[model samples]
Target: MQSALLVNGTLISDESVRQEDILIRNNRIISTGNNLSGQPGETNIIDAGRKYIIPGGIDPHVHFALPTPEGCSCDDFHSGSLAAMAGGTTFIMDFVTPAPGQNLIEALSLRRQEAESCLLPYRLHVGLTWYDHTITSQMQQCVNEEGITSFKVYLAYKGSIGIEYHELEKVMHAAASLNAIVLVHCEEGDLILKKQREFVAAGKTSPLYHALSRPPETEASAVKKVIDLCRKTGCRTYIVHTSAAKSLQYIRAAKAEGLPLYCETCPQYLLLDESVYRKPLPASLKYVISPPIRGREDREALWVALRDGTVDVVATDHCPFNTFGQKDKGADNFTLIPNGAGGVEHRLALLYTYGVLTKKISLQQFVALTSVNAARIFGLFPDKGSLRPGSTADVVLLDPDYTSVISADNGLQQCDSDIYEGMPISGKFSVVTAESV
Candidate 1:
């Protein structure tokens, strides 16, 4: 086992920052406090020297090597994990969407095998698109035997991956029975399909129309539906990649009533807006993500949500596709373009610059949004998201003074276009250490 000591660093916890030294052995932090000592030959000493030592970020939502009809996302486990680590994210919770007629356990087994080469430790949230006795039983097996505590459901993508209303209620009941958390993609599928038809018929099929087709109401309506179901069934529910400010009202009301409901928004939702859809032809397609970026008002609302605790975490929702082959497939029709963006390699630095440096949120709030909250919600708390003693030694050294501009050439994801290109950013990761895989 390799043992090491990190000296003279300010540790960012959920509450505050404190100067401390951390001692690591066998890939775990054995102790953390002032004046920690280590034997010379037994432990290597790393002088952190005024850097911020924060727990490695855990992105609760990420899709790596996702298979779509167009093609697999450009970033697989290997490249995605590398990008995540480069950005100081130590663990990610990805999904396992089983194929038609495929057993849930088998799908998880195969996905785990496929992800054997991933550099960082990872966990899976099984997607339950359809429900039956067998599938319901499998859900229990996943929680009990596979150690997966979170399940995902889609309210959009109708006919394909979306869950029917009645079936979703039953699934929620089942999840509640097992004390499992349900994560949902909240958007009314039928409403989006109808709007798409209207847009295409009017010869308005540009990339900008992608945003027009799914208006804020589409997401807000679905968010309300999930909240109602969670309230009825008593299941802990989390909404993913929430992009609309209208949806925040529902989340806020639910939280006020003490419902076990939580929601996460991504970096693009906070910083980017719908204008990206109107950029150039091929360049604009990169921002055609689902639940597309909203107006400037919504962007400001997300920042407020982060500050006031309406938004529990900030994740990447990182599903990267190349511009050449993947995005060009939908040149004539925006609907064909795969929806996602690459941000795993830039999440930490971007948030630090915009969220912390700009005074929108405090450093402690940043730590909670980036790491601690997700850990507690997703059952990886002390082990993965805290710098406390006996926690897995997943640590990041953040240099607050570093400054740079964003570009694809310096990123680790297997992608051609950088959505945040030319964006000025301060603060970079000096070093990152992940627990043994």
Candidate 2:
């Protein structure tokens, strides 16, 4: 049996942090306590002095190898997982997007095959791209047989992948029936399309116009609509990449009403602002993600939500494309740019520096946002998000004193440019251990 012992580290969980030693056998944590011992010759003893040992992060939102009209996203499963591992994430959840009229199960199987190259343990949230009588049964089959408990739906792609309110309601009902959670990309489709047309017609076809087209109201309206549907259908709903301050009031109210609503915001929405879009041609293009990075008020509001428990998780909607080849395609028209940027490799470090060091959030809250809460919401808790005995041995040893500047060249992601380029980060991952089950 493979064995190892991590000694003299501060172990942190969502609940507490304490100095402890963790013993591991094979892929499981054997025990954790003070002075845990193992055979000297047979076991690997790691000296984790002055390091903070936390559960490996679980990013519930990422889009590796996502196919768009321009091309597939730059990082496929293997490359994306490598970036994730380097950033201290051990388990990641990606989506299984089905083609029109394709079988959901078949799509999931193919996605699984593609994900086989991933270096980290992973899960998939099946996308509900269309509605049909067969979809309910398909969702049930996915949950019962495939172990997929979460479904995703888009509200902004309009005619292509975006579903109408009626369709969303039907999906919410189906998810409620199966006790599965629905992750919604909250943007008003019609408003976005109308604004895009207006911007293009007015000759304002720049990256900044991308943010103008999908304003805060567009997101906030969708959030309110989804919360209403959740209340009506009693479906557990999660809003992904929430980027607006106005949207938070709806989320906060829904959560206060005891509706099964969870809100997730990405690091970009928290750290970056709409000002990045004002930078220059391609430099600004990299930040043109859907629900485009908002203004300073929105960023500060998201940080408040993160600290106040209004935000449930922080994930990177980490779909990346080359700035030259892909994003530049939309230079003449902002609508054509692939709507994403790379952050899977930077989520933990960014959160540690900005959230923890800045006192915006505590270390325990950091653990919760980065790993624990996502696992619990997505049903991977205790095993994937915990350092308890018998839990999967996915742990990260983070050195608090180490600091570094982030750039695409040094990052493991396959993307050519980074949105977080030149951002200084404190705390580095000294050791990452992921034991396979």
Candidate 3:
């Protein structure tokens, strides 16, 4: 591969920043400095126009080609990874749902094949998405093959993907034995379903009931329940899409107890509100995620968690769904509405614009949530998410002063609509390079 010089930008890595020229040999980041000062030569210069050249973001929880309540996720490997790149993300860990009675290794291999032939030119990592007995054996395959180092178990969704109490315990115990981390979607499905039925039966079928159905208590209870099981099983656990501040407090206390627990929050929880669900038409359904968005109090609480270091990472959970027929499918029955919004094209920008500009989190912490922490947790550090000397040259150039209006059209997500449409953002990804770039 030809050598190239990435010059004149604020090089932001896992650690500090420097105005340096990064040398790329093949796909590896060979050197970094001004003028390659006192180092090797023979490289073509690619000026960065003095943008912020940071490590490529690593989004740990994204469900592409994911099957859900409404339908399979709107974004597939090709479209999802394109949005990931357009948003300055270079690597993503997508879940591979193992077929019943299929080998975990084979399932992962199939996922890899899809990714290799995928149209999107970005790095893809696989994780085992488990529902039943597939957890134990597939986890062993993830461990043995190292194709996947993490697994997701739903604590709250007892109806569909939700695991029963014993199944939850068994999965946690299995994960504990395999040294794999279990990430849970922590909204109690039983309580949520009961509330849904009651609300609908009473003729209260508005979108507001979506939140009412899965109240914060639903999430908190499921968190405590899952954490208790994790404690008993001695497993490493992470709460995915943590919304309520009270739930975060529980995890904070567990961390105080030295529990092997970690948690992640999303942009919607920080930037939007439950009121989004009340918006007319497409707008309301756009924010219809599980463990529903909370009130201002919970939103502020999440900011505090991100500030005081109670939270570990801030991933987009970049699971894109349609705002038209897809999300609106369940408008008549909120349960049928798919529970996610598109943000792979906006995760980093949203965090940078909202997190740092608003002073809710520091730039260093932004780098941590968007990069370092994810790479650390997902086991793809130096190679996929870092800017170290030996790491891949994958990077994103951010022009902090540049402003842009975010619309459904500009976004790279395969979905038809964007939840954050028309929102003005200051920072933008001006350029991006992947390992194979």
Query: Each candidate's TM vs. the true structure?
Result: 0.97, 0.97, 0.91
lDDT of 1 by residue, 326-374 (tens): 9889888888889889899899888999999999999998889999999
Name the best candidate (by lDDT). Answer: 2
Candidate 2 on 93-195: residue-level lDDT in tens? 9999998878899999999999999998888999988777798899999999998899999999888888899988988999999999999999999999999
TM-score-wise, the better of 2 and 3 is 2
- Misplaced by over 4 Å in model 2 are 434-437
**Candidate 3 structure quality by residue, lDDT tens digits, 50-136:** 578888887777878877646788888888877788788877777766654456677777877767745433433334334555557
TM-score of 3: 0.91
lDDT scores of the candidates, listed in order: 0.88, 0.91, 0.76
Residue range with the least summed lDDT across 10 consecutive positions in model 3: 120-129
lDDT, model 2: 0.91
Poorest lDDT segment (10 consecutive residues) of candidate 1: 428-437
